[model samples]
Target chain A: MSDSVPAASQSNRGDDFDRRDAAWYVDRLVHLLVFLGGVSAILFILGIFVFITREGLGYLTASFSPSEFFGSIEWRPTSDTKPTYGILALLTGTAAVSGLAMVVAIPFSLGAAIFIGELSEGKTREILKVLVEMLAAIPSVVWGFIGLSIMNPFIIDAFDVPVGLNVLNAGLILGLMAAPIMTTIAEDALKAVPDHYREAAEAMGATRWQVIFRVVLPTAKNGLVAAVLLGVGRAFGETMAVLMASGHSVNMPTSPFDSVRALTATIAAELGETAHGSEHYRVLFTIGIFLFLITFCINLIADLIVRGIRKK
Target chain B: MTMKIAIETHDLSFWYGDFQALFDVNLSIKHGRITSLIGPSGCGKSTLLRSINRINERIGNARSTGQILIHGHDILAPEVELLQVRKEVGMVFQRPNPLPLSIRDNVLFGYRLHHGKRGLKSSERDRIVEKALSKVLLWDSVKDRLDHTATQLSLEEQQKLCIARLLPVQPEVLLMDEPCSALDPSATEAVEELVWDLRDQFTIVLVTHNMAQARRASDECIFMLLGKVIEHSETGEMFVNPSCQETADYIEGRYG
Candidate 1:
């Protein structure tokens, strides 16, 4: 009986071993999951990059005349006579369009973000924020459609342009589409600033505009820069909006009125017609590789900028 | 040490929406003197300092009864531009808030706004910035890399930079809300010494919950409780002789 009592007590103690408090257990699980999941996702993403690079980078290394892909300037693969797939044209177009979009989007988005985050009143600020959020929820295809219908007429008539499907239209639409995401992220970053900063600036006899432009914006610059880089990435990867807005002729567009085809749109447009494993298909994949590299570089830059700001 | 009255709050009362934050608090801020507002937290010490410069207006539906006179001009008057009011009355906060710009930019931000590009030549601007830093005693440490980002400064230096930024504008009154609350002992000492130095050029309303800080820094004391001015006197008189039992009990540490 004494032996039984001791043995039962030991078994009961063992039963209580992993039975932690509910709140404590939940807290521990959440931390564990978050840490594990975050690392695993990063690893999985990195593995995808390695996979794509290994498969797709081979064509890039092929003779152009051994290295025609990166070194060539031409992009017409539909025509015969061993069509050249040099990505210089598509790349130039991407750079131009993305740059223009950023120029339009960054300022307006930053302004909207600041205005929405800093200035507007209780209900008005909330409403504006919600409205901007709704804009983000609108599908990319709907934005493309909207650009074709209303935007086409508005720009064609207002600017006296023959066709609205020019770089200007594409950039304008892209800016509009990108604004919501940009403004939301930027606003979140700006809102993250402590109230004490604004109070300090105001106390320093800084005007409202001064407080905003000088103190708030500068202080939150890392997040603000991240927001802008994110917007540029969106503009680069966007297919339908650019496809509908940018006139898709293979020839290089010199003016805003002239139709431009971004690399993304070109891939989407010609992929079906091109025979699989053909040089054109390989070129499209090669453009994909280019895109992957560019986005990767931008993400790296954004991270570096954030880290730099943090160190300061 | 003899100086004019830099600011006077006459029966100033502030309300956040329907909730009153301060009531009928009359006080005078002497130039080149630090007047500390001491009370328990949430006792309207910070609120009263903020209302002095009409900062409460930034809040939605904030209103005030009574007037704030910065050199006799009623800030509450409609004709007075708030921007100008802020310029005349500068503030320092508990936490050091330096802009995320180069040390030079953070110091001259106020100057640049008021002066614009035409106001000061780059060389002149540098001199002014240097002078302002020297006033706060941060020049020697930060002088080598004036163009480096402001965040690189230590906490004490950052708060000093905030002070330097205000020096450029040369505001008549300076309002400080717990300026040394977030600092270590040495940093707090640095701020305290600078406050004593700056009082010659500016009227200061220094707010703190620490009674010792009030005694150390202030010439006059305003004691607040439940959003009302419970007592106001010269620091010596208020500390040595008590008028109200409540004040006596509070000073005796009955309850915060």
Candidate 2:
């Protein structure tokens, strides 16, 4: 009996060690797969940065005048004899459209978020949430088409503008496009705030509106800032809707009613026609670089602010 | 011969959708005394407490068909403003739920909610904050950092601040739902002492699962079972004298 017991015990130890070895190998394999996944994502972003910079730098090196490119108000890249690559006009057009979009988007989106997060209940809340998400799923081209058909005529008739397609038309569409993301993020932030704060405020005899404004909004302040920054990033980067709605005029726009061409629209419009590896084509990449940097900075600041809020 | 009643509930029945959480609860709580509601989990002690200030209405589909009266006012009346009822009766939750704001701001929040923000000068706010903090016995520890966020304090301090914030509104009654459940034994004792001190000024109703805490801290004890009140008596009498069978079983650890 003693001999049989020792033999069984020895075999159990061997099986245990083999099981542990198998577990170790599986753990290592999972670790390797996760590491590769992370690295590949980073590499893709870095690769885009490198390729854009390499192509864009050729223009700067080949007698591109930084002063004229930045300071002047003309962007006639295909002017045959003297293709002035001044992007000031495009920059202003981009700024005007994005600024107007933000002005139009912030209030409406925040109100929607509050309604969804604080006021809606059960079936209504769920349906509203899903509807907001569906808004985000609509294609940019559809928005552009809608703006061209419906909004253009409305703006022309209502405001008596010379042309239906202008900064105002494009900005309103862009604002619509940006509103979904803003609503989603702001609503998430508002919901993330614990219910206890609301209860405490209510227990102190604060009205529902007062509780939302005083307790919930202040607690979600950083998140709201992040949401706005992210919305700005989305509006600034949007291309197709603005392209179709704006009249694509290469000039510095001074009013919401003026026809204008954004940097994104400029690139989308010109990149197809320009000869490959030419100075003009390279300048387009430079504009791409500028677009990239602006979006990157805004997103980075938003991410940092959100992280700080989460830590607190 | 006439005892003042702080809170009176008549035929109180509460439901969460089809599920009844509380049933026909009739309770008359005396003024200036601490009453502890003790029951097993799911016996609806917390629900009963939350119903007093209509906080239960926050849960979607949760309905109540009953009359709840605070100081002779029918809180469930259609014309009664919910804000006024909440102001008269304050509640502390199971967890420490100080707003993510400065310590001073947390104390002044209730006051500012009832009174407009611009009406109170900075000096007056400071005085109110100081007095409230001092009442909770947190003044000495947090006085140096009134501007600091309330969340940065220890859990005990946070719970105290939660209680302190309610005082500025001068609530006639305080409802605590397991206020010390999140604290250590020593902190629990300190909080119980604070509750005892505040009892003279406010009618305090506390819900606790800890029978020993209910016995040691409360002036009156209520035992509930399966969403029904088993007994309500003086703390000593409830513990020492014979009572309902379920109360005896629960106290003797025979069954929940």
Predicted structure with the largest lDDT when compared to the true one: 2
- lDDT of every predicted structure (CA atoms): 0.82, 0.91
Model 1: residues with Cα > 4 Å off, grouped in runs: A1-63, A70-83, A152-163, A310-312, B1-6, B29-32, B139-142, B197-202
Best by TM-score: 2
Fraction of true A-B contacts recovered by candidate 1: 0.74
Q: How well is each residue in A21-116 modelled by candidate 2, as lDDT tens digits?
A: 777889999999999999999999999999999989999788678899889897777787888889999999999999999988999799999999
Writing each residue's lDDT as its tens digit, candidate 1 over B10-69 gives 888888988988888887778877898877778999898888878877787898888888
- DockQ of predicted model 2: 0.77
Cα RMSD, model 2:
2.5
Give residue A154's error in model 1 in angstroms.
5.0
Report per-candidate DockQ. Answer: 0.57, 0.77
Off by over 4 Å in 2: A1-11, A20-31
